[model samples]
Target: MRTQLSIPVTALAVIALAACGAESGPGSGSGGGTVQPDVPVAGVHWTVDSLTVDGTRTEAPDGAHVEITDKGRARGNYGCNHFGADVSVEGDTVTVRPAEMTEMACGEKVQNFEDALRAALTGRLKAELTDGRLILTTEKGDSIALTSQQPAPLVGTKWVVNGLVLGDTAASLPAGAQDKAYLTFGKDGSVRGSLGCNRFTGTAEISEDSIAFGRLASTRKLCDGPEMDVERKLVKVLEGTATYELNHRSLTLTGPDGEGIAAVAAEIPGEK
Candidate 1:
């Protein structure tokens, strides 16, 4: 049995804010439950939901996908192979496992996924949504944390601002932000953006799973806009989500489907 611990209220708040897309860009959610790990449920579908172990950013398992039906029916492609899983959710408590997998081995990422799937099928979780995205948990605390395989950064090289990654979960926004408004991160401490409405600047730091973005002050006067407001939400929401991607030069971010968010990424200025 994986260790079970009370998740801090602050963390819950942060997770909620991150999933719900609030003014403060925080995360939110709650609850704890006793479970029989592999218990089966009748209606709700429990799916992959996320693929953080492979350093899921906006662009992850670039060629893979996960989809679940409303009745808890699910089917999708994991980057290297096909997979199927069964899930049961007791309010916030979730139990999931991949009932099917391709015989072909896919290295550590796939293997880790196999392990997490097994745990999720039996381990207990505290699940919810904050900042407009869904979060699933197993083992309550971080003891069962999966290692993220973040890609290399082409920073200072001008890759577009794709999206953020929090463990295997991703928060992406293209619908709310301008289709033309864009971004770039440099080797220096500066992070700049076009805002799709106006130019704005902020400081940034690239970490293993999180990107610290803030002091998001903008140009002198605000652009006459709803787009700006939309951009604001997108930026703030992105701050809490960790960042990741497939190709930085491509400036693309992708969100896992059903998570209620889209993946985001940027094209490298000079690259094709």
Candidate 2:
């Protein structure tokens, strides 16, 4: 289960706060009082939980999340497509400019959810922070609920390959190869997984910024072209030392020539 933030407010402080309410006396303008700190919204991995609009609540898909940086950048996935936008925060208001997103064809359900999320995240929003949750409400009363969470650790995570990265561009896996390749890193300096066609196990030297994979031994198996294509690409990434980045539940391993594979942390069955 996710953890919630706790803040203790004393009775005397509450009483004093009430007493410092607006004054009706002459020339009593807004000036001095205990100013509450703005909510810490940046640099946190926010898992979008749901969107509430017109009294209806819709739960977000498994991988929907948003992360805002202090450098005026906002990047996140809306169910299927990943998006980025320029954002500005003033007091408790967050203004999001129009976002640029990837053009991926999605199923009906995911497309609908993505459209709703895209619409709700635009323009200026009032931010309300309570416990560990952050709610961003649009002027028309629509709201998006999100919860904070730490990034998934590299080791012990089931990373399922979702796309291939060549240089700076990301491309989807070959047809019929989706969800067929996966990798898991072990604490005992071992790595093992399916290569979409064959099963392999090998040693790995993991450091703070890179992973050095040893020669992998795999079972001899024949597969179709699509599967073989995925296996070959993954093999390239698994060879030699590769730098890695973990963004929320997403993982990217890039080889020396900037070729790599992108994966996501998949839930192990019966482990959640």
Each model's TM-score, in the order given? 0.33, 0.69
Task: Report how far residue 61 has shifted in candidate 1, in Å.
Answer: 18
Give lDDT tens digits, candidate 1, residues 1-272: 12221111112222323333322212222323222222122221222234333344222333233443444445443433445555544445554433565443444544455455444334456555433234445463422221112223546444333333333343333344424456667778677876556677888777654466666766655655556664554555445433443331233332232121222333433435
Q: Count the backbone clashes (under 3 Å) in each candidate.
A: 49, 0
lDDT of 2: 0.71
Off-target runs (Cα >4 Å) in candidate 2 are: 1-42, 50-63, 77-83, 88-93, 100-115, 124-126, 139-142, 267-271
The TM-score, computed over Cα atoms with residue i paired to residue i, of candidate 1 is: 0.33
Candidate 1 scores a C-alpha RMSD against the true structure in Å of 18.4
Instruction: Give the least accurate 10-residue stretch of model 1, judged by summed lDDT.
Output: 1-10
Q: Per-residue lDDT of 1-272 in model 2, one digit per residue for the tens? A: 11111110111112222233333344332554433322344566677789898879999865677776555566676655677665545545666555567765555666687778767766667766566666778889998887776677788989988778877667667668878999999889999999999999999999888999999999989998889999998998898999998877888899999999888878643347
